[model samples]
Target: MNNHKKEKGDVMVEKGKLVKISYDGYVNEKLFDTTNEELAKKEGIYNPRMIYGPVTIVVGEEMLLPGLDEALLEMEVGEERELVLPPEKAFGKRDPSKVRVVPIKEFQKFNIRPVVGMPVNIDGNVGKVVSINSGRVLVDFNHEFAGKEVKYRLKLEEVVEEPEEIVKELVKMYIPSINTDDLKIKMTKKTVTINLPEVCSFMNNIQTIKMAIANEVIKRLGVDKVSFVETFEKKKEDN
Candidate 1:
């Protein structure tokens, strides 16, 4: 009975595991972020320029909010959870000290007419204008999400087990344009080798991508080696 692929109950999310998940994050019943393309489009916040896909999160890596990252340690593949995270664990309570008053002339000097709720960057810190009076503007520099509870709807798609699968997942994530299934793969006890797609030969950062993918596989899957093979075609004249 313990022979087939891991039973649903047998697999539990744990630290250092490579897992893929899709999530929709909300604050105050408004959709602020999501990995679902259809939902993004329906909410009128869709951006065609960005890549949309399941996110690969290394559990316990602090790659997510403190509370959400902790929640991943208790999730199982195929489990969809709706969770609410408090302010301290989410983004921390808002800070009034971060609120500043700036003269309206300052914005006008930069060709900007400051308006309520308008975002502006000052000294590399982004803030939003909350009020305007006479010749002054009130800007709140705290995180837009601070002092609020954040709700997340998350689903773990898969808990990658084998080293080769980890490599494939990494390639799929880092090189979204490549079709990992069609790429040749050969796996040994301690190494996973993959043939690069023909189109990737001209990729600006192919080597970087390879190194990053290999490093992630080693770090997450504990594989010894990952070799990316790049083959060349013989010219007709030589043949």
Candidate 2:
């Protein structure tokens, strides 16, 4: 695609393109989530841990909900739309079977004191405790917003085109602490090589991050392989 010559707002977004967008998600007209910091604050749902701003997503990669992914492909850069998604496309209908009663002994075994509305993980599945009565704990395993219709107001900010920019965006998404400008990325016809910073060598999850980065780049960029090179230099003694 000769994306360079196309002016901003004229390019059509397609599958595998990197897209940056700002969105406000609501359920029953009540804001549930938003990329705008001010709106989140105004709605009294501000989360300090969340990095609020326009988010970048790889289109059609299931990075977003199924409904949103479908909507993204039809949008042009700078276009804005509001969409209402049914339960199936949003979070799926809630299942009655997902609500189960567990014996109080199970919680006791884990040294947990079950309380109403407490979130707990059981056998690797996350659930919320609904009620605790007479030696039994009721847990609901459904997603918090399951069975609810959702609304999203989305603005397509930009569609990223260049392979180098794509790699940088991926790296930034994975390693938020690292500066993309400091990264050394080399791309060939069928491969991408990334020289990681020295700090990455000390992170316990660096291997997993490298694997995720490699997987995305190869899958979305159609590269045969992605390699990460980590180098640690020795410091000389003070003269």
RMSD of each: 5.8, 4.9
TM-score per candidate:
0.73, 0.83
Residue 209, model 1: lDDT of 85
Local accuracy by lDDT, each model: 0.83, 0.88
Candidate 1 residue spans exceeding 4 A from truth? 1-11, 100-124, 129-139, 176-178, 198-208, 230-239
Residue-pair clashes per candidate: 0, 0
Q: Please, what are the lDDT tens digits per residue for candidate 1 over residues 124-169?
A: 9899999999898999999999999999997888888766677777
What would the per-residue lDDT of candidate 2 be over residues 146-193, giving only the tens digit for each residue? 999999998888987789988988887888667777899999999999
Among residues 3 or more apart in sequence or in different chains, the pairs in candidate 1 whose N, CA or C atoms overlap within 3 Å are none
Model 2: worst 10 consecutive residues (lDDT sum): 1-10
The TM-score obtained by model 1 is: 0.73
Candidate 2 to native Cα RMSD, angstroms = 4.9
Alpha carbon lDDT at 14, candidate 1:
84
